[model samples]
Target chain A: MNKSIIELKDIKRNFKVGNEIVHALRGVSFTVREGEFVTIMGTSGSGKSTLLNILGCLDTPTSGEYLLDGVPVRAMGKNERARLRNHKIGFVFQSYNLLAKTTAVENVELPLMYNSRISASERKGRAVNALTAVGLGDRLMHKSNQMSGGQMQRVAIARALVNDPAVILADEATGNLDTRTSFEILVLFQKLHAEGRTIIFVTHNPEIAQYSSRNIVLRDGQIKEDKVNEHILSAAGALAALPVPAED
Target chain B: MNGTNLFKIALRALNNNKTRAFLTMLGIIIGVASVITMLAIGQGSKKSIQAQIAEMGSNMIMIHPGADMRGGVRQDPSAMQTLKLEDYYNIRDEGKYISAISPSVNSSGQLIYGSHNAPSTIYGVSQDYLTIRQLSVEDGDMFTDQDIQTSAKVCIVGKTVVDNLFPGGGDPVGKVIRFNSIPFRITGVLKSKGYNSMGMDQDDVILAPYTTIMKRILAITYLQGINCSAITEDMTDQAIEDITSILRRNHKLKEDADDDFTIRSQQELSSMMNSTTDLMTILLACIAGISLVVGGIGIMNIMYVSVTERTREIGLRMSVGARGIDILSQFLIEAILISVTGGVIGVILGVGASFAVKYIAHWPIFIQGWSVMLSFIVCTVTGIFFGWYPAKKAAALDPIEAIRYE
Candidate 1:
């Protein structure tokens, strides 16, 4: 009975590559309810990136009915889509795309900079809160280059959470991290999800599907399987079970 | 995004590349500095020239006899004695704008005081000649009307003449000096004027009564020339017209005939020098302006490189809810900040350079407020003009491709 935050119906996308129409997404359909942690899994050439882009409002499906937070998205213009994306979606990339040489608090403040209604002081307050929420309270003033990969990714997550978007859309968010750091980031995501935050994590790694409540597998531009996992693995439990490494 | 936030973002980006930003601003700095310094030099020279003309009596007018065409043979202006004492008297009596008037007749002679003799021109003039020529008697008194009435043998000696004829440095006043075998008592010593811009010695002269030069020396009935000063500098043209008409009537010239005497004023010479200096100023500014254009091109080039280098940053901002226009403004503001900062520094450096030139190089320099304002506005415009294309390119980028850019 939960309200659907994202609903895609028969979404199709085509690209013309040198006079050949290549189908990137063919008749894809899904609905993600509020507060539900969903994983979109696919191999290469399976249109998962295209689906993530459409869900993030970075791209529009060629023909589809897309309702994000009950607002139709496919009919919106480029700028309106941008505004919708700003207000309703937060993006976390695999590379931890924090602005270089910028402090964590400032990087977290980036999303709110686009919102004119927020004053500078309010933006700083929200950024500080978001960073604290991501367990980066002590590293608020640390620059991106001065932090490790896991710390930089946490800052990126802090940026994604600052705007209080309807859904946090992560694209292979922990792909570049080592096994231990990946579990640490996954644990943070699991914690955010437990706090009733809607998350749509897209990746090619099938092992990540066990951590989410629902899984949608894409194959050859179509959804091959959509199912629910009754037993969701806790990333925090997995991180604690790993052996402690020798001190460097 | 709001302007200030975008500005802060742009500022941070520039801070990341401080060395590159400073190097980029160097072109605009040199260009604006040269423009201000050049304009200062030009204005300074023009002012100095005008001041020198004012020192020579800004409103003084000279009436010289024009060359006469006699039976297909042209007579020299000095040989033509059309300007007479009658014209001088007429101008003094009828000219409403005339403040001072004198008749001039000169004879070159050797001035002897004891064993010292100096070759100098003895200018025969009335008492008013001192005011007309802006000359002052430093010691003793000027000749009175009695001296002119009696065709006085009294004279005034200048500093050069004093140094030559009275080498012993005693008072030249009341001392009799012989000119061309005629002994004349020196009534005063004129103040030293040193040399003029033309390298002419201004203090090497003797002043005697015009009547004496016409009767005793040249033995001529007609005067050589006349000098008149207008009541004010602005009344020079009117004074010249009045003198011309009076001289024409006195010489009995017809309405259609040209005047036998020629009139000239210091204002004419001043305007000529002013035009020359203005031309030089414009030429220097134009040359400096070319460098400004080059500086603008340099901005465009650096902005392009910055856009290319920060593709990932632009993509990240866009993903974080920044619109295309926000990205564009961020880059544009960065460019403007560089230029405006350089402009401020350029203005300070230019003013400093102008003073340095005035002190070190001994060249006159005047810093005009408008010139500083002009360079500032120009540098701002240069920022916008050169920053547009690259910012547009950055804004139009595809976020996906930009994020993936190597």
Candidate 2:
């Protein structure tokens, strides 16, 4: 029997602008089992980001229910929701929202600061470990200003993983990167998935969704399709296919 | 949130905006400094005045006769010879609270000692006059009781009189001085006591036995006024009462009548001056306190700006598990830190200002420990009170909306 880690039932979000009411999300129902790598694809204003925010515990559904690890999240208090977000959910934004003045290691340690169980030294160690997992171990001290767009995204990924969260929520994590950098970050996501971490990635690009084990397409605030991808790309396979760089 | 962690975060934020934080604290600094400095000046002036009064003799009391109306004309009672030697003797004998008493008679004339002559006052007083007025002999001895009994022509000259009548440094003691051509031997010289508050030269007079002036010079049996000393400051009222009763009996005044003389005690003057200075001090402090309120408002303005600027950070913190109370406490701590730091600096500045006033302006300044502590506490409270709203605004932000804020 597969244990479902996240479940959404007929979730809807309505926004009132002046005199008009806009439905941002409507009758969206979905479920993901443990350790599943799922990607939701959609165009701009397609409600994919809203769905990601709701899944990340950053926002509550206006109607219906959201369950994380079989626990009702919609009815939780603010502190409870924050605790849930800190312990089980981590988010990576499209803009790579790493604090501007902080280094990669410090950015990664941000999530651990919210978790009191970890000592400062241990938090640093775990942050260094997360940065190493994202292949930025040598650039731990480099701030976001000193890093490229791809590197900054990797730092954000490291921050999302540093807490050892149950699920990683990435909202267009590679939307700002070039095609080559996008492939690299997708490979990193695949690597993280291989390590038994569940990930829900939101993207507008179909080529990026090909790296995930499963894909869900959203359109007009509703789920259009959900399917398993037989041709999902593995990180090691993708890396092997890339041409090796010559030592300068 | 743990206090240490909150403090660390507060310190970091303050450090991040050092100049802005300092400017926000400037109001508190100036307010506290001014309060402390003004209180010091006020207290110092009060203390100095008290000291001057005490030096003039804390136990001293002056008596002035009431006005006497004669034949539908208001006359100066002092000129009417209302105060008498018998009344002085009655007060001295009947007043238990009085330590000493002396009757006085004053006349201005040229005092001559061997062709060197100068204009000065001649005061006829009893033996207790020197002690009552806190005067001491610099040379020889005071007039003897024999001088009073026989109405002898002998006197004690003050320092300025001696300097003028005997300018060549000869011994004026035991030497005869001519006052209006009346030969009087100088028996002693009084030590210098600078000018009194009324601009009278305290050490520029010659003192003779009261009987000498009454029988020989003025040919009067009454006194111009009486000077007395109470045993202690607290006994002044009792002494006044006793002297008033004795004088009323001596003067044969009827019951239910006002006393014919007014008694003024040094203690009353001291307290009156002190209260006036205290009121002035409080007024100055109130004026300075207005600046503290303005400073608090400045802090509120800056804190409000800071909260608005860090809305995204607030959202991030809330999303990461910080409660509203946690955010509120953090901001409050930051404000308090600014105020407390400013207060400390202000205290130093106040002390420096006091010293500056003392040395440069030649004014008395007394910095008290309590004033510093009080100002510091007021500053910290101002910071907390003023920053509370901004902190609450920051705390009350919705995490979801804040995180998504552009």
Candidate 3:
């Protein structure tokens, strides 16, 4: 994959907290090419969340040149930014953020409601395809409250993919799950990565970084490290090593 | 997002808290209901007064004997005996505008018919009194001109007198009912006239020839009052003017002196009643409007609460590519739906309540179609007006801050 889906240059963000200037991101810059599985690692107050917010188009950098698939994001108007978020970027939250009591297919169809070009039947069809792609074909009718945490996350993933966005951004996607369930979700990400999907993961867990193709570590509002993970952890291999579940 | 889909989502959100939604709508429902009911009551009374005026003969007039003032006190006109039988004759025969006339003499007495007895007032009038008073004989026939000339003992009994004299609902015509020990044959029975607004039973009287009543009952010579009717409702004032001029010429009263006779018309009573009822309707409608305002405030309060409760939902929708206008429209639609729904329900309830009052409570109720339509329009405006603040608040929220809100 030669094309870059996201590019940032000298992205600076500051805030005034009671006569104090807090620099959340001090001129950080990076580029993530298409089809890359990149993980951004940081501890608390490292400004990774702020950086993710800018990437998700939920916030704009105070002064920076940020581009998503060659479109200038910082200069976009509010409605334009919203349209970009709807069509290009997909988000997966640590809490899964799947609408409670909403069926998986319905949740997946949410993003399509904003896309007026899509017909109702086409929207439903695409939602089903997306859920099936996330290995949740049988759980299309299942609501978040009725599903296990892992299953709910999968439903959230289906929601993120339903619009066929250019890049999928996950923030602490496995932070709430146990070790076995984390690996199962990570393996699903690996499968998606192998299908030529661009994925950006943000987490504080160092162990999770080893599973991605590249890692970028942030320290004190600046990038401290950026390199490929030479010894990649195979999530499927890790999942296979765990003992089989006992029948209920 | 499309309006239909946005409203669908809004409807679903409201459905999530069914009890709250219903409670919120109660305010509007009550407001609309009170507005409709108050207007109906006002309209109903106005209509009833008009009906009474029509029943009293719209074109009719009354001439009362003017009272003789003793110092600052004016005595009853009936005791003055200024109106004479000749005035009634001249008005009936000479006046072009006058259609009918009857010299009236009133006497109250206890009537005895067989073993049954009733106390009723007697009115002495000629056959033309029926048309002048807008009364019709429902049984037998009216007394002839010979009855008045010969001072006949034939008389007509009104519905209440019939009910009292004949308990079994038999035809009272040709039956003898003695008034003050003077026996008279019932010549006819008048149709029922129901009761007046003053709680007076209008059909509680018996009618006889004025000459007979004056000689036998009251032992008087002069007529008490003269009942006259004009050719049409509009001509009543002219007929009264003609009678006054004719009476003044005959009585030979000086131009400076006050006349001894007074001419009255149903229009005077009608206008007075209409103005009184008009003031009452306005007063009642204003009071009812206060309830509608209270209902609107309830809507505003609930909408504010709803916006606060659904902060996270608003954030979610905003983040999902919903523009500020989209968020605004969603919340606006929610408010409009609640109010319009409430308005529709209130209309049904108000109409039902009015009907119930009319049928069960035996009260007059006139429901104006415009009032129902007005309530609908008012409620819609109320929803939009009250919902605007909360909807704007929701639309103006910071998506990130909202998402993080508990």
lDDT (Cα, tens digit) per residue for candidate 2, span B338-377? 9999899889998999899999999988888888888888
Query: Which lDDT values do the candidates have, in the order given?
Result: 0.90, 0.85, 0.87
- On lDDT, the stronger of 1 and 3 is 1
Model 1 steric clash total: 0
Over A195-219, each residue of candidate 2 has an lDDT whose tens digit, in order, gives 8899999988887777899999999
DockQ of 3: 0.53
Q: Give the C-alpha miss distance for residue B66 in model 3, angstroms.
A: 4.1
What are the TM-scores, per candidate, against the unseen true structure? Answer: 0.96, 0.90, 0.90
lDDT of 1 at A203: 96
Rate residue B267 of model 1 by lDDT: 88
Which candidate number maximizes TM-score?
1
lDDT tens digits by residue: candidate 3, B1-406: 6766787677766776688889989999998998898889889989998998888888888888887797989998878867777777777778889888888998988999989898888999988899987899888999989999999998998888888878888777888889989999998988888887677888998899988998888998798888888989899888888988989987888999888888889888888999999999999888877887788889889989888888877776767677888888888888998999999999999999889889998889999999899888999999999989999999999877776678
Better of 2 and 3 by DockQ: 3
Docking class of 3: medium
Query: Considering only chain B, what TM-score does candidate 2 achieve?
Result: 0.92
Clashes of 2: 0
Candidate 3: RMSD to truth? 3.2
Give the TM-score comparing model 3 with the true structure, all chains together: 0.90
